[model samples]
Structures are given as structure tokens and as C-alpha cells.
Target: MKKIIVLLLFFITTVTKSQNELGSWNIINVNMKIDSKINVFTEAQLRSLSFYNQFHYYEFKAGVSYKINPNFSVTSGIGSYNTYSEGGDFELPMKNKEIRSWFQINMKNPLQFITFEHRYRAEQRFTSNGYRNRFRYRIGATMPLNGKKIVPKSFYLSVWDELFFTDKEPYFERNRLFVGGGYEFNKKIAFQMGYIYQFDYKINDESGRDFLNIALLYNFDLTKKEEKEFTPATTD
Candidate 1:
């Protein structure tokens, strides 16, 4: 784990040194497990057009997820998304104000050395321009560097590609590709850093942008634990 982390840090540092400038995508995520099958989560994001400069977008959302089995799950969420004009920190004359709701399904498959994930989402957007519907699909893979499973104190590498679609004339809206590494601090906390490239199909302001993505994730267990063990009576 230590070696993997060192390598990942070196790679990121090299890329950052090579680039002139890159945008920043920061996220904080909190998840609570209500039981074995139910979970709730909240997330907030802040994004800048330059390295911590020209802050342009922010969002906050909350959601609930249900696990149908080991491989499949469903989630629903609602959020307020706001985008600012790109001159300074949250510049006036907001470019877009949106209230969005989405429903998504996730599927997971574990292989000998890697795990693959598939996500499909449908979104309803109430934006300043008008109301619209959008769809998205993402495929991702993760591999543990030191062990077969990504348990606590583990390091893993992940890559994903996501495509976005809308019901408009052009149909395709955006595409995003991400490559990153993560370190699990314990069963409940983790940190991830990565690079992402986003391309907009003539639809958004943030087209052809490269971002340094940083995220902190936390999980909490809310289930009750039994303190006593069951014992059987012996007849003498």
C-alpha cells in the first residue's frame, strides 16, 4: 500500500508539473448505512475553472440507495446546481441555475484481478432555460494493487468513462473520462485523487477542460450490534 501510494503521488505530481494549468474539482461525500440493504448519502461539490481560481460551479445533493442483492443497487437523488460566469470567484450574473433529480441503477462484477461497474442514470432538469430530460451511462473498472479485495488500508486504481445524452436535436451532450487512485484509511474513510477530461458537445461552458479531481469519502454504520451470544441448554 505504501509503495502504491508513493507511485500514484509521483505520477500526479509529474502530470501537474507538465501542465500549464488545470481546473479543480473538489467533492465531499458522506454515506450512512441504515442496515444491510439500505443506505443514505449526501455530497457537495465545488469546481473552479483554473487552479483554485475562477470558481464557477457548486452543487449539493442527498440521496438514498437500496441494495437488491450483492451485484445490483438503485439510487435516487435531488440537487441544486449553480454555475457562475467565468471571471472570478462565483461571478455575478449566474450562467445557470438548476434543480435536478435523477434515478440510477448500478451493477458490479468482480473478476480475478479487477472489478467492473456499470451505471445508468436518467435525469430531470429544471433549468433557467427550460425543463429537459437527460440520460447518462458510465462504465468503470478498479483494481487493487496489493490484494485481491479493496479492504481497509488498501490502495486501488480506477478508471471510468461516462457519456451524457439529452433529448435535444444534437442528442449527445457530454463525455467525461477519469483516471485516479484511492487509498482507504479504514473501513469508514478514504481519499481519492485523479485527473478528468471533460468534453461538451456544444452544450455547456466547461467544454474541453482538464481538471484535478480530489475527493474525501466517509461511511458510517447505523445498524445495531448484538452484545450477547445465544447459548443452548444441556440436559444432565
Candidate 2:
């Protein structure tokens, strides 16, 4: 399709522009459906200023999600986040060591082959510097390239923009924009890679950076053995 080709070209162009300064952002996510309305999930991230080198940041988190309806869900999570100096691989004298807890809400609207998603989150951060409160919102859309829905062997495209703010003066904090695509290998596994541009206001540790984002997602259903319709995992 003409639209698909245009999108692909845009993706390639953007990545090419930032290739020289691109950082690495990698994630692993696992989700398990424990009941009809409850799910448990865990995620980990590792990041570097270069392609697998100059490692600087990492985080691990686990949470529970409750589906309130077909269109809405709520989640709560806690995580350990660490950031190191940028010169070496996780160098000494970490810049920031943080324990973060967050509450989030998600809403979805599906139209034909595309789904529009909205996410809102509030975070309580306990960091080496001090305690802080932050809020974020993201709007995203996903479209299946090969089928009406994301199923086994399907390919999909996703794009999102997120804004972050804090409670103090100069409240506007950061912005993140992501564009990427993924392939569904089966009902349980999928892999995604994309480009992300992040901009921070007056933040010194993790400021403006272009990242190559890669993620692996796994989903499991514990209640039944029968195969069901696949639901693609969403990332932040």
C-alpha cells in the first residue's frame, strides 16, 4: 500500500538522521493472566549511550493490572531505577539511585484495523537527591499491517508521544516520541524495535538522546490451555 510505503520511508529517514548519536534502549516484558480480569507483569530495561556500550541506566519493575472493562484498566507498580555516569559501563558513583512507585490508568478505542490508546500515570519517586512527584500521559496508535487484528504471524506499526511534568516550578519536564514496528511470532511471543527521541528540560543526568529501542514480549494464560485470540503487548 502507498501509505505503508510512506511510513516505512519516514522511519528509515528518521533513523538515518540520528544514527551517529543513537543510544540503545532494551526491554524485556512478561505478562501472565491469572484470572479473567487480573494480570501480573514484570519488565526490565537496560540502556546505553552507544550500541551495547557505555551502559548508563537500568530498571526492573513488577506490577498487577486490573481490567475494569473492555476499554479501561488500572495498574500499580514499583521499581528500582539506577543511572550511572556516562563515560563508562555502569561507572562508580552512580548519579541517581531511585525507588519508584506508580499508579496508572489505560484506555483503548479500536476502529477497524487500528487501535488508539491513552495512558495516564502518577509516580512517587524516592531518589538519592530527594523525593519527587511526577505525572505523565501518553497517546498512541497501533495498526496491523497484514491483517485486521494483531494475530500470529502478523506485523504491526506503532507510534506514540508522551509528556512528563513535575509538581514544582518549571513544571514541564520531559517529552518522548516513539515510532516503531513489530512482528508477532505466535500467540505468546513478539519482538519489536523502534526509534525514540527524548528531551528533558533542565535535566542533566539523562538529557536529550536518540535511542534505538528493542523489546521482547511474552504473554501467558494460566487459567486455560486452549488457544485464544492473541493480544499484542503494549509498552511504555
Candidate 3:
């Protein structure tokens, strides 16, 4: 459809645009399973309950930052990170709702930074016929190359491998991979995104497994601390 083409171009532009100052993630993705058995978690979760099929999915996630140090911080809050069914009759194919949380440990070097990041999630999975309960975990790293140490204008890149854990009462265990990153505008704002290329699995819509992810973080100063401003000396 025309809309799909527009969206594709939107993602392409979003990724290449360096001036995007949004303090959140805005990732665009185009995938084709890259592998078979596409949605591992969905298949396991809905193995016994039949209502969905193979299809594609798209998602978006945004959050705020809590700076612990120049190189360290904790991100908390909410964002839109969940799984929806492929082309179907029902409007509510929202089988998974991701409650986002992450802890990032950074190592600041001379011209760049290395981060060992862990993303934890509590997901609400829905069955084709009824409702179900499930959870997923993602652990990865983001490596960023800072343009300037004092006033960072742009960032290079980062990537990571993920191991997804799930207990499918209906099926078996499944795994996946998540790779992505973004550029920082300041300590309070940023723009970035990622993609999830899935492996061996099955679902009503396999496309749902291959998704685009966007992340934005905003830091609000809760505690106010006043600092003395510099005063110019005058001749007596």
C-alpha cells in the first residue's frame, strides 16, 4: 500500500538524520524473518491455544533518563514496546505489552564510551482464544563513539547480542537477537532506534517478530541545587 511505502521512507530518513534532537528512540526496520520459525516466544506461548498465525509486527519504545554520573545512569518510565499480530480481522492483536526498564553501566574513555547495558521487561501476552501471562528478558551492550568530549555533537554506533528467556506453558523455549543504538543531544535528550531479527519459530504473523524500535530519554531535574555565579571585581 502507499502508506507502507511512506512509512519505509520515514524510517530511512529517521535513521540518517543526525539533527534529530528528540530525547527518545525512533528506529525504523524492514525484515524478512532473516530466518525461519520467526516468532519463538509467540509460538511457545500460543502453542496450545490456536487463534493466531504467521505475520509481521512493528513496535516503538521511549523513556526518560536518571543520571547517576556522567558515565552512568538508570532509565525508568514507560514506552510503547510490545508485539502485535499480523494482518487479521480483529483490531486488537496486541498480544504482548512490554513494561520497559534498563540499567546501563558506562565506561568513558578519551574520545568515546563503552556501555554494558541490561534491559529487563515484564510482558503481558494474550492468547488467540483467551489471555495468557508471560515475561521476556534482554541483555546487551551499546558502544558509542563520542565526537567531542566536552560538547558531544554526534555519536558513532553500538550493537549487542540478546538471549530471550520464556516459559511457554503451551510450547517450548525460544531465543532472539536485538541490535541497535542512537545519538545524544545532551545529558537530558537523545534520538535512537533498533531492530529485532528473529530466528527459528512460528506464529500467525511472522512479520510481527521482525520489528522496528525507537528509544527516547528525557531527564528532569527533581532536586534543585543553587550554585554561586561568578562576580566581576571592581576598583575601589
Candidate 4:
């Protein structure tokens, strides 16, 4: 059929132009609760172009979150990124930086055997080149491997797919697919390691990259108790 021919040609062209590269992404995230409805978080990341070396970039972010219910939450965050050349070159004309602000909404759904999270995000970016805006959506699912729930001391499987879009001519930006597993150390900390496949589209070419993803997550609660005023005793 005509459609089959077009599909075959597309696959052939993609395979011929594909340049596979390996990279690593490391993340640390901490969340602190201010009250039942409010929370804050900080995150940092180190990215590399090689297995464990050849530094690529670093990012820092801070954010506040508000919980609407058990299943829904909203967050606003600001981030700074410093990026170098592919081989860790930081010389002039090879380095760039960006500042970005984002807002996101997250929702959770419980299924029979798997739990799913839906995230919608919008970003305002100020890059070395200019300003841009993007929107993203991701759907993630987790299933317990050794227990009924993803509780402490349990391992779970995690998978997600995300897509990015812009408002320009080529509205489609990028896509990411991830598969990984996490082990909950306790109620407050956890670790996840996985692999990510990223596909990016440009004006005339497309590229594919593979990444090793590593993450550490920390959670704590410090909700304020009832407010009270203290009266000092007056001497007579």
C-alpha cells in the first residue's frame, strides 16, 4: 500500500541519520511540609555526556506546592541552568545559561494493580539566545513488585512517557520514555535508577539519545501546631 511505503522510507531515513549517544542524569530532591496544605521543595541535578564523566550541565530549582486534595496538587518553581559543550568545554562561544520559571499540576489515580500520575506543566524560559515558552505533559505509572503497596522497604517498577510542545512552526519539540525501579529505604527517603530514551526534533534533523537516570528523594513533615501568645509575668 502507499502508506506502507511511506512508513518504510521514514524508518530507513531515521535509522540512517540516527546518532546514538550515552549520558547520565543525576538528581537530588527534598520536600518539606509546612502544613497539611502547603509544602516546599528543593532540587539539584548534574548531567554528563559520558557514562560518568564529561560534564554537560547542572541545574538548581526551588519550589512551593499546594495540595488541593489527596489526589491533586499544584506547584510553582524557578530554575537556573548552566550548560557546557558536549565535551565539557566551558570556553567562550561554547557555554550558555538559562533561567526558567514553571507551574505544574499533578494528579494521581489508583488502579486495580497500578498507580498512575498525570503531570501538566508550563514553562517560561529565558535562554542565552532569547525567550521561549513550552508546555509538557507526562503520564507515569508504578506497580509494587513485592507487596500490595509501594511502602517502606519495598521495590516498585516505574515507567513514564512525556511530550513537549511549543507554539512555533514546528510545534512538536521532544519526547522522553523512561523505565526504572525504585527502592523505598523508609518513609522518608527513596532511590530510583533507570534508563531514559530521548528523541528530539529540530528544523531539519532528529536525534535520539540514551541516558542513565539516577534519583534520590527525601520527604519530611514539620506542620505548625496551634498558634499561641505568651504573656510575660509582671513584677509587683
Candidate closest to the true structure, highest TM-score? 2
What lDDT score goes with residue 80 in model 1?
Answer: 90
Lowest lDDT block of 10, candidate 2: 226-235
Instruction: For candidate 1, write residues 1-236 as lDDT tens digits.
Output: 56757476637742764544688889988887787889888999999988889999999998899989977999999999999887899998888899999999989897988889899999999999789899999998988777887777777787889999988878998998888878777777888778877888878635367888888888777776431211110000
lDDT of candidate 2 over 1-236, digit per residue (tens): 73476368446835686235778899999998898789999999999987789999999999999999978999999999999987899987898999999999999998998999999999999999899999999999988888899889888888899999999967998999988878889989998878888989986557478888889999898987654566666545
Deviation from native of the Cα of residue 54 in model 1, angstroms: 0.9
Q: What lDDT does model 4 reach? A: 0.71
Candidate 1 Cα deviation (angstroms), residue 102: 0.5
RMSD of each: 8.5, 2.3, 15.4, 12.6
lDDT of 4 by residue, 81-173 (tens): 777766553323446678999999989897767888889999998888678888999998887666667777767777789998988868998
Tell me the lDDT of model 3 at 41: 11
TM-score, predicted candidate 1 vs. hidden true structure:
0.89
Residue pairs in clash, model 1? none
Cα lDDT of candidate 3 equals 0.37
Better of 2 and 4 by TM-score: 2
Q: Which segments of candidate 4 are over 4 A away from where they belong?
A: 1-19, 89-92, 203-208, 224-236
Q: Across residues 87-134, which tens digit of lDDT does each residue of candidate 3 receive? A: 442235566554433332323233235445444444444434344343
